[model samples]
Target chain A: QKEVEQDPGPLSVPEGAIVSLNCTYSNSAFQYFMWYRQYSRKGPELLMYTYSSGNKEDGRFTAQVDKSSKYISLFIRDSQPSDSATYLCAMTQRRAGTASKLTFGTGTRLQVTL
Target chain B: NAGVTQTPKFRVLKTGQSMTLLCAQDMNHEYMYWYRQDPGMGLRLIHYSVGEGTTAKGEVPDGYNVSRLKKQNFLLGLESAAPSQTSVYFCASSYLAGGPFGRGTGELFFGEGSRLTVL
Candidate 1:
């Protein structure tokens, strides 16, 4: 099984709708969770990041992590056409004296239409 | 600053032909990584360097080699290109891990990307 699993969704929604993207993982050691946005022909950029099992809010986006269930989610409120892109979930374990390496999910493609 | 820059934005390679993809970072980060993105495969790490002169293999490292002789540059080499190797390559960099809480989250800054097609 892959370390991280996410629904490869080409999910389309109307503008101003609420969007939720999620991912599940088997590695309990993962402590740092992150969300990344990738547009067509572009590299993925860090969107939101959370440590351990908790929720972090930034602007219109909220990231939630449940360590017990090994599940994480990203919620977008009042979505816009400019927000259309692929969302990927990545996680890594924190190790002292070593650089953390992230393991990413397959990513969910989201499109917001007017 | 140009956080990370990849050379040869696009390239076409014949089977068995060899080429090197260059990645330069102006952030002076200690950790550098190379990843390939393909349909349904998100991003798979090819190789990474924790520091200059040190390289380690990631999930997908076969048919590819890497060198990090300098602190600011990381190079990915395909000794014998294959059709299966065609994909968009990305380079990323980050500061050292494990600082104060939420201080160093290992948030990576990525380059635009290098699209390679193997014929």
Candidate 2:
């Protein structure tokens, strides 16, 4: 099985709706969780980040990590057309004085319509 | 400054052909990475460089090679391109201020991806 699993969602939602994207991983060693948004023809952009389990809020985006279940989520409030993009979930372990490489999930495509 | 830049934004190759993709970073970061995004397969690490003159194979390093001769540059090479190698390639760099920050730690500062198609 893949270490990380996310639904390849082409989820369509009306503008202003709340959107939730999630991923599940089998590796318990993953301590750093992240969410990225990728527009067409561009590289993925970081949206949210969290360490260990719990919730983090930034603007309209919230990231939640549940280490016990190996699950993580990104919540988008008041979604807009600008929020339409491919959402990717990533995880990695902490490495001192070096860059912690990331493992990403198959992105979920989101489309917010007015 | 351009955070990260990749050359030849797009390319198409026939099977058995060879090519190299170049990635340059201006963030003065100590780490650089190459990842391939495939449909439903997600992003798989092909190779990475911790610092100049150091290279490491990642999860999917087969059929690919890499070099990090300069602090700001990393190159990924395909000795013989195959249909399976067709994908969007991305290069990323992370600042050293944080403890080994990955893409999640902050904006990874990715270059516009290189789209490759091998027939």
Candidate 3:
């Protein structure tokens, strides 16, 4: 089984709608979850990050992690056309001195239309 | 700062040809990584460096090799390319600050990808 799985959604929604993106993982050791946004021809930028199981909010974006369920989510409120991008979910386990390695999901493409 | 920058934004390589992709970061970060994004496969790690003069294999490292001779640069080399190696390659860097609680080691700053087509 793939370590991390996410729906490759070309999910389209109207402007002002709420958008939710999610991912599930098989590794319970993963302690950090992150969301990255990538626009066409651009690199993936860090959107939101969370440690362990909890929720972190940043403006219109919210990231939630449930370690028990091995699930994580990113919620976007009042979506706009500018919000159209591929959202990638990534997870990492905390290790000593060495930096953690990341495992990424098949990005979900989101389109917020006018 | 340019953050992380990748060279040769696009390239076409004939099968068995060798090429090197360069990634330079001005952030002085200790950790650098190379990942390839394929259609439906997401971004899979090719190789990574924890510090200068150090390299480690990642999930997909078979057709690729990497080197980190400088703290600010990491290079991924394709020794004899294959059609299966065609993908968008990205390089990222992150710093270790205040242990692991403040932010992830993978709080990556990415570069504009290098798209390689191995024909």
Candidate 1 chain A weakest ten by summed lDDT: A92-101
Q: Once model 2 is optimally superposed onto the true structure by TM-score, how far is the C-alpha of residue B86 displaced, in angstroms?
A: 1.0
TM-score of chain B of 3: 0.94
Which is superior by lDDT, 2 or 3? 3
Using TM-score, give the best candidate's number. Answer: 1
lDDT for model 1, please: 0.93
- Model 1 sits at an interface RMSD, in angstroms, of 1.3
Candidate 2 residue lDDT tens string, A1-114: 999999998999999999999999999988889898999999988888888999999999999999998999999999999999999999987665656588899999999999
- Candidate 2 residue A43 Cα shift, in angstroms, is 0.4
| i-RMSD per candidate, Å | 1.3, 1.7, 1.6
Candidate 1 shows a clash count of 0
- Give the winner by TM-score: 1 or 2: 1
Model 2's CAPRI class is medium
Cα lDDT of model 3 by residue, A1-114, tens digit:
899999998999999999999999999999889999999989999898888999999999999999999999999999999999999999988675666588999999999999
TM-score winner, 2 or 3: 3
Model 1, span B9-101: residue lDDT tens? 999999999999999999878999999998888789999999999999998999999999999999999999999999999999888875333
| Model 2 misplacement above 4 A | B97-107
